[model samples]
Target: MKGFTSYAIKNLKSTGSIARSSKFLARNLAKQVPTDAKTIVELGAGDGIITRELLKYMPQQAHLTSYEISEELLALLQRIDHPRFSLKHSSAMDIVQDFAIDSVDCLVSCLPLALFPLEMKHELLTHIRSVLKPNGLFLQYQYWLSDKQLIKEYFPHLKTNWVPLNLPPSFVYTGTAPNSELVAE
Candidate 1:
């Protein structure tokens, strides 16, 4: 079983701490992030796959900060050493407390939300809300739809889109502040 897991990890390009996300899903999530955003934060930045795409799409003047729980992936990112990118070797849940309140223009997460316990999810979402700018967006992609209610409860004004091109398909949930609403059908 260990050998099989290792084989799967090698082929899937996934570390034990991160999920293997499809390129299609990454593109869709990238589109949701505003290119003009000044300060962007990425949660669960595994292997820097989405990080590479974000740097490609984000404006040159923008600053991109990423958090990765895995020391291996964090070390790997440091080796690439992009000037516009800053990586934190920490858990996504600690982002709000680590950074100043309302300092982030956007929050993009590729976290495996379904794996987290309910209390942890709620706490993270609360922290995310506290740190985000009033007009900022919080984008999260998940493989399952079971957590839709949990998302809606935390982010009352939320917009959801499905990207079927992903390996296992995925849902992108974009959350906005109370007074804002996305014009998605």
Candidate 2:
């Protein structure tokens, strides 16, 4: 609760910020979060490092909704006073029920998707796809490619990029939801 590093170390398994060394990664991640996005949701908002960076770049009309189940991390996130920012003590899977379908412009996830159980991971990805706008962006970072195929199932248009500056390094996966009309055809 004291800081990003302390909270991450104390709750290593649950906290997504394994290392307080994501400065460069956060910057790049923030850059990818559509600036014109009217609504943005961030999953696993670890201590608001990336959230803070997002505030700096998001358009004046944009709003960032961050989700963090860890109270310790949430406390730090709450300290970031910004009119355009909001925090949710919830999980990514609830997104569909929490927001309207096709409402989100971008969803940035720092969650350890590879570690999630297969069924839960699929469920969450499904929810993400349902809540995203037709042209929405799904930006997720992970240390491994275990969830690559699962993500592909939900978002056929996908690209992967490496962020070597992050601690332990990570891959940034950018994806867009598949067109429902095309799938139906």
Candidate 3:
């Protein structure tokens, strides 16, 4: 636990917490992962804590693709040993390169959007919108509410839940994809 916390602090941008996420938070985030989902993707899957929690809800036939930018943490995630789990060493910003349009059923993101620059945030949201199915779910947890309006621009049906069990408390954002045709029309 000590070493993991050190790693998380060292990589705050990716891990987004001083301590690893509590199982309570993990459970709350994973709760929305329906058993019927075929593909689940995780961004900044720190130490695979949430990664493991996600697996418990995943159907055996489902595949989970996790992206972890911290090389040190990648070693921990590799120990997952699940037949359907795969790890990628890349940033979520480049997700479009690896996936086709409307490919992801759910994207569980641990990225710290609050710390991102405005332009980078826009780029990330655009890339995120590209990969999600029209009905796809986007789950994100943050310590601040500053970015809610920005996210609403892309995901019109955004809602939130607050989890005070974490070390610093957090807000979980659940959003449905925006209607592109609504904009086009």
Candidate 4:
């Protein structure tokens, strides 16, 4: 995955993981996805590493839509040619406008939240909350725990786990979009 490293260096601010270390693959996705998930979304799907892993574990009938803002990565992702995959050239915040509300069952993100400006992170989470089905899952990994409080703001019921096998290690944050009525007036 030389191309992946090159892209990561060139887009350090946008790229989070040093590499898609195989060690985290099982822990990242295997047990998280519900067996019946119909519609899943992936944010910051760089070079489709996690995207491909997600596909391998997803139920055959489930469809996954991955969003990548970088055209360079999007080109590589589009070539995967999976029948259940849909690649979107957009930012995570655009999901609300790009898809129907309450339509997504799960969202796995590789976004570098700690590197983002506070407002952009907040705005993205707002849109994420809007598009997810009630109690939908948002699984994300970061190299640091600084964003723990930020994630808690958007997803109240949250837990974190550590995966040391990855380069530089990583923390996996699992959260659920609160049931819609709980957040509504």
lDDT score for candidate 2 against the true structure: 0.83
Better by TM-score, candidate 4 or 1:
4
lDDT by residue (62-119, candidate 3, tens digit) is 8999998877888888889988898999888778998898998889998888888999
When 2 and 4 are scored with TM-score, the better candidate is: 2
Q: Which 10-residue window in model 3 sums to the lowest lDDT?
A: 176-185
Runs of candidate 1 exceeding 4 Å displacement? 1-19, 179-185
The alpha-carbon lDDT assigned to residue 163 of candidate 4 equals: 85
> Clashing residue pairs, candidate 2?
none
Model 2 lDDT per residue over 15-124, tens place: 64468748788887888877678999999987787898888878789999999887777787888999988889987777887899999999998888877788888778
How many clashing pairs per prediction, in order? 0, 0, 0, 0
Best by lDDT: 3
**lDDT, each prediction:** 0.75, 0.83, 0.85, 0.81
Q: Which stretches of candidate 2 lie over 4 Å from their true place?
A: 181-185
C-alpha lDDT of residue 178 in model 4:
84
Candidate 4 C-alpha lDDT tens digits along 1-185: 35887778777777865565454754476468878889999888888778888888998779999999988888888888889999889888889988788888888988888898988888888888878888888888888899988888888888999888777788888889887543421
Error of 2 at 116 (Å): 0.6
Q: Whose TM-score is higher: candidate 1's or candidate 2's?
A: 2
Arrange candidates by lDDT, descending: 3, 2, 4, 1
Residue ranges of candidate 4 with Cα displaced over 4 Å? 21-23, 181-185
Model 4 RMSD to the real structure?
2.2
lDDT, candidate 1, 1-185, per-residue tens: 23323433664433322335667777777777776688899998876778887887887688889998766566656765688888888888788677787778889987778877888888888788777877788899877787888888767777888988765678899987544432211
10 residues in a row with least lDDT, candidate 2: 176-185
